[model samples]
Target: MRLKVDFHDQTETLTPEQIVLIENLLNKAAEIEGIEEGSEVSVSFVNNDEIQEINREYRNIDKPTDVISFALNEQDEDELAVIGEGIPNLLGDIIISIPKTIEQADSYGHSFERELGFLAVHGILHLLGYDHMTEEDEKIMFSRQEEILAAYGLKR
Candidate 1:
């Protein structure tokens, strides 16, 4: 699968190495999840204030979140249709808060890279229709996240 990840670092906080790492991890994740060729996803890095504004506007939550995902293809059965055969699948956006990631890494006692990878994978999973709204779903989603992270050698 040719997974195209468009990264927008609004905060300009990610290094080249970090960008490469995220690219590799997200590609592996797309392959494992059977995303078709030319599938596209956008990842954006923002500050706490920007993310908090997004959170409040989108989720109606006032606090800044570490990561937030907007999936484009969560369609009901009746709404599903084949746009085209050769068209790229637009997965959606993964918005990450740089400051929140740093704080979470410190709080979780893990590397910033690890936390970043986790959030990226988590966002991708959401794009693939995974949710943790229930206990069983949480188990499935969290376990998959850990497994993917471990497979990519970003183990906690």
Candidate 2:
């Protein structure tokens, strides 16, 4: 249940509770997936401008996204394994766009907290290698997200 979180944006202000919420949600995901308890994960907050740059750089898309996850689990395990003493599993990174999250929350008729929870869970799933490039994939991904969010009482 050890996670290292880092924020990379200026405008995405979050309270300590919100930070802890993300950490809890990450641990919930790991627990449901039966991953190790001492897992390592990082969540980063970003503004639209910063996310736009990352989207273009990594995804070749020129638009800002609500959230994006870069997974370390899909790569070579030996290469990614930490050498430190009792180091947790390095899951990877979740980058969230602040302004975009606000707008999407408004657009989707949900509270800021609910939207935040959804995006955080979504990002974790991606880090766990879930994608929605197809219809069935979309169904499974969204269902799992809804299930987790509901369990956390974040469902609408």
**What's the count of clashing pairs in each model shown?**
0, 1
| lDDT of each residue in 1-156, candidate 1, tens digit only | 369999999998799999999999999898888888899999999999999999999999999999999998778778966588777789999999999989999999999999999999999999999999999999999999998888888887
Q: lDDT for each of the candidates? A: 0.92, 0.81
Candidate 2: tens digits of C-alpha lDDT, residues 1-156: 544555454664987788778777766777777777677777888888888999999999998989989997676756654467776668888988878878988999988888888999999899888899999999999999998887777776
Q: Which stretches of model 1 miss by more than 4 angstroms?
A: 76-82
Worst 10 residues of 1 by lDDT: 73-82
Candidate 2 Cα outliers beyond 4 Å, as residue runs: 2-9, 76-87
